[model samples]
Target: MTDIASFRLLQPLSRRALLGSAAAAGALIVLHPFAARAQANQAHLRIMETTDIHVNVMPYDYYADKPNDTMGLARTASIIGAIRAEAGNSMLIDNGDLLQGNPMGDYMAYEKGMKEGDLHPVMKAMNLLGYDAGTLGNHEFNYGLDFMFNVMQGANYPVVCANLTRGQLASDPKNDDLFFKPFIIIEKTIRDGTGAESPVKVGFIGFVPPPIMVWDAKNLEGKAMTRDIVEAARAWIPAMKEAGADIVIALSHSGIDAAAHTDRMENASLHLAGVDGIDAIFTGHQHLVFPGPKTWDGMAGVDPVRGTLMGKPAVMGGFWGSHMGLIDLLLEKDGKSWKIADFTTEARPIYHRNEDRKIVADVASDTRVEDSVKAEHEATLAYVRTPVGKTSAPLYSYFALVADDPSVQIVSNAQTWYIREMLRETEYRDYPILSAAAPFKAGGRGGADYYTDVAAGAIAIKNVADLYLYPNTVQAVLVTGAEVKDWLEMSAGMFNQVEPGASDAALLNADFPSYNYDVIDGVTYRIDLSQPAMFDKEGQRVSDGEGRIIDLMFDGKPIDPEQRFVVATNNYRAGGGGKFPGIAGDKVIFAAPDTNRDVIVRYIIDQGTINPSADGNWSFAPLKDTSVVFSSGPKGRQYVGDIKGVAIEPAGDGADGFALYRVKL
Candidate 1:
């Protein structure tokens, strides 16, 4: 069963505040003395995990410039001490994606470079929390190797990864020149039921998604390579066993997918769990949770209620410090080795939504974690608050999935403008330039409060960063009209097929990531929800039926299959991210050095007072007597009247505090 446990620390922060600023230099707070004893031959071990923290040291949102209850290491840190007091032996670990995500990460990389002896703010916070170990996630390679290496030097704990190689692979996966230590054997003292103390060796092996080769190709094309998650596990688990590890745990940065295992698959946690010698697993990189009601409902070999994958204990903490994954294990002595006799897993939240749809923090912020990075947090606030330009219309992504949106339109406009100017003096200047942009925050796994909402006023660096998330550089690709049509067909998989007369059928495919729902702005088309999707979520052709994209037009004429066009996109897509059709390294015509966010900032500055109204380049085709339902943040209700060419009304409350809306097509 899902074993979520919550215990309040009485006046955790208030005591520190009462002591005033003098407490900053005082001794660190300890929840309980580590003097508890367990029964002989059996022990209780609690494994705590924090994944995808993404540089959120304080309980604040840099984009909105306000305190947020949902995400922050400080909030998660409040319960760490209390959680440790419950078990005789405990280990706190991080499951990677620690380096980059929010504006603080951007500020550190761009504004404040990581020089020698300079510790990263996130690493400092994790060190203060006394993390035992951590692994590498795919996002760790985002800022390039030198910057990543500089940041890794600050980590106080052992960071291990079995799959990533520096230059080339050796003859065997075990012999590969690993970028980090393959696995570490952590020695610990365990207390048995008889109060007898003994030594136990816990081994942790780490693995990342193999697609980093494609996602960050610019930084990792020739300099690095990766082994498959399952392949690497099969090779290294034996070595860890021979190294005298009594119990083995796999820190898989990949997600859980029950699909048949293939080499280089992105979500291979289920397959990795089946490998021998792995006693338990910690999963992340999908920003999801195990033992949760939704997300993993009917997948084979995945028991959400029991929190098991292939019958092995597993947990995936929600991203951005929203949840802390805990796996409680009862270890029994079996001859020379320790076996997992029983276990209970949970993804505990730092905050909970009340009946009134407001967030109520379960635990107060841990003052020690907040104080560790106070200087960097303050500097990051100053950096993001610097004004860049102004916008005439509000930019939000509430209806981005259902209609053309201003938030995405602004990014598309900025990309098109930047690329047009970059290629104006080049040989390919006359080609028709189209920009493809997607909504990075559309309230999927990020929860209801994750959408981008910028008021129409003076915009700052944070607002521009919100307009275009990620640090991808601008890239222009040359593609034929046929490839463009297939591209749109691939993106159309975001919506689920609706029957012509069906009422309130689910509109969106929850598994489809919002980042892959690319909306090409220069072409106009209608998404026919009645038709079957030509491409699946993996960008593979799954049907031989009519495509969902209909009446495709460019310049008021039917697009020709032979006509070649220049598509302005980010390096992630041009380098084969999301497996888009006919878009890869060979098609890239111009790769600019400037980042996409920087280009947006430049565009806003050039326009001075910019207008970010969506031009309505795409829409849903009419299906008589059909109404589909979807959910967004409750704040979307106010902007429902601003939507064009569609009739949307409040349906009711949705699960997990989202407000459902019905759209008539």
Candidate 2:
């Protein structure tokens, strides 16, 4: 077994002290600059990262019910095996969120019942590939503590997380909650650039967002909670170096969006990189790839071209195994200690989406991983494929952004039904209930074929899973009609600011996550493209000017500003996941412990046959003589005849084969 290094309490770290220690850490990395040239006892080692696997053990899409080349750790194993074969020394590590995401993970927890002796498919696959060390992602807590512990108990490798420990108050400055180890040091032999073998002590410390306590409060309340990631790093990193670790790699489950160098930031990787002792950082939680063109646009302190974070190598392996983050390091022996000489980063993909939208696969499904977890994989397939209910019309999200989509409609219907039933016994039953749902399978970065397509007929569990990808629980928040307007205005951020009349004007704001573009049922409104967004991505209002929302009405009348209404949404949104207005606080009136997927399934089963069609509750405010262009999957061509509202026609091919459409108002 590899050696485990317990984080001994050196000193308690206050918020101010953590910041001061972070300053000191930054100084250390700068003073110990990367050495130049090939010196005595030098070598090259490749660090392989498979982050946000999300329990996709097989090279298959459980939601799509087909073989997927882009996702799954099994496909990633082919990359790891090849990279390791070409390197003198290498370490394969995961960046967390391996426990849950899709139906297979759901099946393992709900149906298969992770018994005492049962091994999780993710654990089986990782063991077969020989993972060095790993950490937990936020999704790991979705199924609650017992289930998470059951999954981790089957692991053959050590998984560390500085935050999220059992039996401790998350609010305490210093607490003894050592349910899991904070860090681990691996002893490995690597040849220096001079081709001389030397021993290296590689230290690994993990961090998850402190917001997990709020995100998964049902599962984690009074059981496990997260501390501030930056604070945890400050307390543990210096201690790791003191424990004789040659190099420290931060397995941060946070993203790199934190421009402010402060504690408790959700995306704290940027701040963590500024710390002195961290040699490199591997991040996830945003499901975006570092050193990629998508994130290179004006991000501070990130050298996307070179894949460096604060002059140190960093990577965020594309989520769901779409890409494997690789960091090749050149190490040299300085006296007896190993120091980084040079390094490079690239998020290598299992398949490439060419400019022409062709999927060029790098390798086939890994037989080793497949065979290792063949039993569990097969069981999950059968569970999701089992027929649950029926649909009268085809359900797809091809033009979800441009039109009211049936895919999101079904989700809203489910939430609305669940909320109405739950509120019947309460005094709030008189209030109007509005359901908010977003298209999770809309074709975007997942490629042109990523959109959900369920033919009119028997709907399976897999089809329902496609409609709602996350395991978020149902929640109802009470907001005034004015707050509701602000909420809709925030969702309008998905569209780009448009001129009154221009040829081929861009429509979609590529920065705003499509998942946050919630279409609220039980209301009628129009998005005005001519106006700039009032709210930014962080839900902060940039202007009080006339917002894009026009003709906001409920029950065929203009909503009164002071009127009260109940809005149904998932726990993530209600807990301030997108920073939407009037959410995540005392305003939340109802919290249902059932996963939204279960609610969807129950709705489907309750309704013998779903009327799969959007209610046409919202549309874009007509911009006379103006045409806006937006992109959707090429599969959208099959459904343009069914879309309502403004006339939409195919313009041409878009990036990654996303069918470009011109909406002539």
- Our model 1 lands, by Cα RMSD against the true structure, at 10.6
TM-score of each: 0.68, 0.68
Could you give candidate 1's per-residue lDDT for residues 60-173 as a string of tens digits? 878668898889998888767556656677898999987777778878987899987889999888877777889998778878888888998998889999999987888899
Can you write out model 2's per-residue Cα lDDT over 614-638, one digit (the tens) per residue? 9889999887789989888888787
Global lDDT of model 1: 0.84
Name the runs in model 2 displaced over 4 angstroms: 1-39, 169-175, 261-263, 388-408, 414-458, 465-519, 525-551, 555-557, 560-665
Scored by CA lDDT, what does every candidate get?
A: 0.84, 0.79
Worst 10 residues of 1 by lDDT: 1-10
Residue pairs of candidate 2 with colliding backbone atoms: 25-275, 25-276, 26-275, 26-276, 42-192, 42-193, 42-194, 43-192, 43-193
How good is model 1 by TM-score?
0.68
C-alpha RMSD of candidate 2: 11.6
